[model samples]
Target: MNTLNYLHLDEKRVADVVTALHLLLADFQIHYTNLRGFHWDIKGHGFFVLHSKFEDLYNDTAEKIDEIAERILTLGSVPSNKFSDYLKVARIKEISGVTCGSEAVEHILSTYGHLIGEERKVLDLAAEAGDEVTVSLMSDYLKEQEKMVWMLTAFSSKTCGK
Candidate 1:
């Protein structure tokens, strides 16, 4: 029996938090899986560079997933991890079948862009509801996602000579 009083979460706030948790988790899973694909099948002039970059990105994404799940638990709610659960909650579409390296980047850029937009929505929702923890988590997460989106998109352009 815990003596401390747990915070009372409003119904709407809880729902929003759950939605954001699931959405962020989905982003993490997609990024992690896509990075693995890029690392394995990168057959370009910049294979080594891309491989190392993807490795770092995937590792960081895995850490964020753990942190996001822990934050959800801190709110006394379970974070969803089942494939079915993710599929239902994730705003990002899964890449079907086989895709080449360059094609993978296309999918990643589109999905990452979508995730950046979704993170903004979650951040706004948290702020409006006065959920400081969720707001802080989202603030940090959004910055990282923005940087990743920039890097991922840069690889799709002429600046990288791709």
Candidate 2:
């Protein structure tokens, strides 16, 4: 039987999983901040509609940030809390002053793309390590994010008209 940091996973596998989780955590942090910016700065003809939508998106991202950190701890590793660390590891960059509704929606879709990609990597790692908890988490996240991506794509199309 393999053991890692008093857990039942192989040490190397756990390390790999922890690394992936940390990367995901960083990506989520960046995405969260970008969503917050969108919520606060978004303006246009759709202000009334997009404002509330951005609020909902940021709130959901905040919850995801907490969930990712908790999962890291569950894997016997510390989650990086520094914004600097997040910037370094995240594929998503900080966005600011995005007032246009279509621009914000486009950025949201791009951020989700990065997030889904990272989650896929985590899913693969978790499955290889037989870590069903992480696997389930990633799977659920992927499903939610993919649907969000689809919705955002439709929203970004010219049909929505900024």
Which stretches of candidate 1 lie above 4 Å from their native place?
1-12, 96-101, 159-162
lDDT of 1 by residue, 1-162 (tens): 211125545656566776677678877787677677777777767677777776887788789889888877766667887877777767666654433556766776777678677767877887776677777877887788788778777776766433
Q: Could you tell me which 10 consecutive residues in candidate 1 have the lowest summed lDDT?
A: 1-10
Best by TM-score: 2
* Best-matching candidate per lDDT: 2
TM-scores of all models?
A: 0.80, 0.91
Give the least accurate 10-residue stretch of model 2, judged by summed lDDT. 1-10
Please identify model 2 stretches exceeding 4 Å from their true place.
1-7, 160-162
In order, candidate lDDTs are 0.72, 0.85
Question: Per-residue CA lDDT of candidate 2, range 110-140, in tens?
Answer: 8888788888999999999988888999999
